[model samples]
Target: MLFFLPDAAAAVRAYARLLRPGGRLVLSTFTEVTDADKEWFQHLGAALGPYLPASPEPAPGSPPPPEARLRTQQSLADVLTDGGFSDLRFAEIAHRTVFARPEQFWDWLWSAGMRGMMESIAPQDHDAVRTALTALVAERLRAADGTLGWTTSIRFTTARRP
Candidate 1:
């Protein structure tokens, strides 16, 4: 089995060109469903009402979501077929990515493109959202070291073709 990371789609396509018949491509990636911390993002969306587009955004200092596309099983199948691959199988599972604090959470969201989405929130709501986020992290999500942990769903997709 061969393993690949994001940009894997491109890699798969490339490898398909060079792969001998019967070779396989196995891969998966991060997905938005992983945003089980939706409540936090919801707070950000509610706060950034004006600055963000119709989509949600993360608070300042947060990392934006990655640019990789989130594909459904069908989509993954299509991608594989279009890439000259066949016999596709895909599975999505919940995974936790832990952060040490609300600050750390904010940091990743900012860098993640999620921040642009959050920038639209109204300034007046920022403090309220911020406080609620802090409380949420402190009350339920924090690890022993004081970092916050959130669920991020990932899809393990694989395919083979002759």
Candidate 2:
């Protein structure tokens, strides 16, 4: 069966809910320390200006923007155990999505259906941020194709219950 869960905790629970006797679940999400998450957020913030905010709501529950609680792969495995899952397998995959020019970033942001949240920024500021972001990408990612290069931290784990 194919199912997608945005909520990490609930995803585990749902995993056990299905999967007949020997069902397979292919799970993919961010790892607590996948790598380069901070840089990606920084890039997004520079491009979003005030809308991004200086510091996110500093509290326990709920994760700060960009830096959500994907912390540690081991904990995810433990959560699976708690959810009555066995035969757990984990793999590190490179889901590092990167963009080159500001236009590319903007395209990804909007066309990718992830732009809804970014609408809070003023139009002018958004333009300025995009301008600055163009340079930022140019500075950071220097590929032969003139595109940015960055790595995203994603951990792909699969588990089954017997």
lDDT of 2 by residue, 34-75 (tens): 235567667666656556545555588644444344446676
Q: For residues 1-162, what per-residue lDDT tens digits would candidate 1 score against the true structure?
A: 122344546756887888788887777665543354567657555544544446456689653334434445665676678778988777788877777667566557667646765566576776665665567566667667666687667778777867
Q: What is the lDDT, from 0 to 100, of the residue 89 in candidate 2?
A: 85
| Candidate 2 wrong stretches, greater than 4 Å | 1-11, 34-36, 43-47, 51-67, 96-102, 112-114, 144-146
Clashes of each: 34, 4
- The collision pairs in model 2 are 32-70, 32-71, 32-72, 96-152
Name the weakest run of 10 consecutive residues (lDDT summed) in model 2.
1-10
List candidate 1 stretches off by more than 4 Å.
1-15, 31-40, 50-70, 111-147
